[model samples]
Target: MDDPPRVGSTDVAVLPSDGGTNQPTVTEAPTTPTVTDSPAPTGDRTDPEQVAREFMTTYPRDVRELSDPTFLASLEGVNTALLDQVTDRSLEQAGHDSDETYERYAYTVTGTYQGQVQAFYSMVVARPAEPGEGGGAAENDLPFQVHSFDWAPGMIGDEDRPGPAAGKPVPITTEEREELIGQVRTDVIDPILTFDPDESPEQRQERLDELTVEPSTVTPPMSRSGRYAMIKETLSQTYSTEHGGPITITYAGTWVDPYDPTHNGSWSLTAAMAREDDDGFVVRSVEETAPSEGSG
Candidate 1:
């Protein structure tokens, strides 16, 4: 049987040999650039949404790419339509600046795996509040920080989508998605994001122990402090009130590796119910389920 759903899961593709130059054309700091509509061209395959989904799927597995400038540059052959969709949706969902200009900083690049085509997504975010005037060496040198990521499954690959046998496959239910996300926050992502090397070992263990327990759907842990709290709050309000039904989520990427300090070296998969609860959903329990065939 397949493992249950759990929490998890950006774009950018730039194609080579196209009319446009490979080097970045826009140089100004991305302080809300005026985005213009591009002339329609033929044969664009890389889609932003697909790129985002691809980003989710691949990023965790290839952590080295995060720091690789050349690898980041090579992913330009992706379909912009998918890339745009995913970036637009994520930016809106994250409440980051979602203006069309943001797309200029995003890209979709494709890769081949097992004779199959895959995509990677990335965003070049401008660092906030830098010294010195705009449009100078600082602007040219690492002006926009490149955060490279992979396509997430549900939104990009065949596995993430509804099976053709099932008709337009149902998206993993929002309730299920949110619940899994909550558990991930509590158990994995949040702890690692908030870890303080300065804290006493006992305190660290205490926090880790708290994480081992299943989290309440209504009040989940957050990875980093500050804005992360707001993300949690937003999820709580959006999901618990509307989609707070029984659901399960599974951690599918780097989150599963034990050696990784990136996310507490733990990833989770969850199974949940279809309806809501008065106390809101509390994790009934946690256990390792059997992995699907071929995964083991």
Candidate 2:
């Protein structure tokens, strides 16, 4: 028989993905990146929120903790569809909350699983002192423990789209495709264009010019901060110059990342150069777009 809804059960109740109206975001699917092994948290864990955050950050349970048994119990209310996702191999951005009512916890989790699918859902916990056990008779004995978990299932394979057609009057060879990608990196991508919603073309160019010829400004984490982001994978192909005159041979491609291995997003670009000229294959422009659902 299913367990009864108790004090902390409300915390485990399914929550909205957007946390608005307490409604789930069912209309839109989530993104799935490829699963990758990430470092786990170690050291002191004196707080319940800390433990729950750790569970959400690097979930899938590479190693269980003393708190896991109760944490798992808290999850009993979660549906099987969503519970299956708890074995996440790679978790994405997670949101969390706790209630004073029952000392409850709620987590909105998303991550990549082994099959390259995005598993998203919610986990709620009703955290309160359990019946007195002999181990610690003292009232002040402290250790924020979990009593139960509530769950709500989200999407499994989202954040992926369809591939672009490689239809060109003349098909470029595999070698040509690789060559074109390399050229695009230097001529177009290297100079780098920062995305700005309101910025104009001239403004973008001006901003690009002001920057030094250095890689992007992302600061590499000194160590595993437990923060995770899905790595997006790119695949490319080239077309014949005959398809488009001045455009020469067009290069088209699709994106497939760690999550949602099933979906592929479209991307393409054009360049101008002679057939035999390697350096001459200068990039005229490039376009890397994400699906409306949003993916790498």
Best by TM-score: 2
TM-score of 1: 0.23
Error of 2 at 224 (Å): 70
Cα lDDT listed for each candidate: 0.30, 0.33
- Regions of model 2 farther than 4 Å from truth: 1-43, 56-101, 113-119, 125-142, 146-152, 155-296
- CA lDDT for candidate 1: 0.30
After superposing candidate 1, which stretches have Cα over 4 Å from the reference?
A: 1-104, 110-126, 129-142, 152-155, 160-207, 210-296
lDDT of 2 by residue, 1-296 (tens): 22312223322111112111122211111122222232243444544445556656543443145243423322222223433533543333233233222333334455554454443444432333332355432332344433222222223222363111111111122123324445554444434422344556576555543321211332111112223323333354343333224323344444343444444344444433322111122232233332322332
Candidate 2 is scored at a TM of 0.24
Candidate 1 lDDT, tens digit per residue, 1-296? Answer: 23222232001111111112122222122233333442232222122333334344444344232322322322322233343332222221111223322222344344443344543222332222332456553342222333333233323335356321222112222222324355444544454334353566566555544433333232222233312311211122111111223333333322222232342222233323221111122233333433221122
Error of 2 at 280 (Å): 68
TM-score for each predicted model, relative to the true structure: 0.23, 0.24
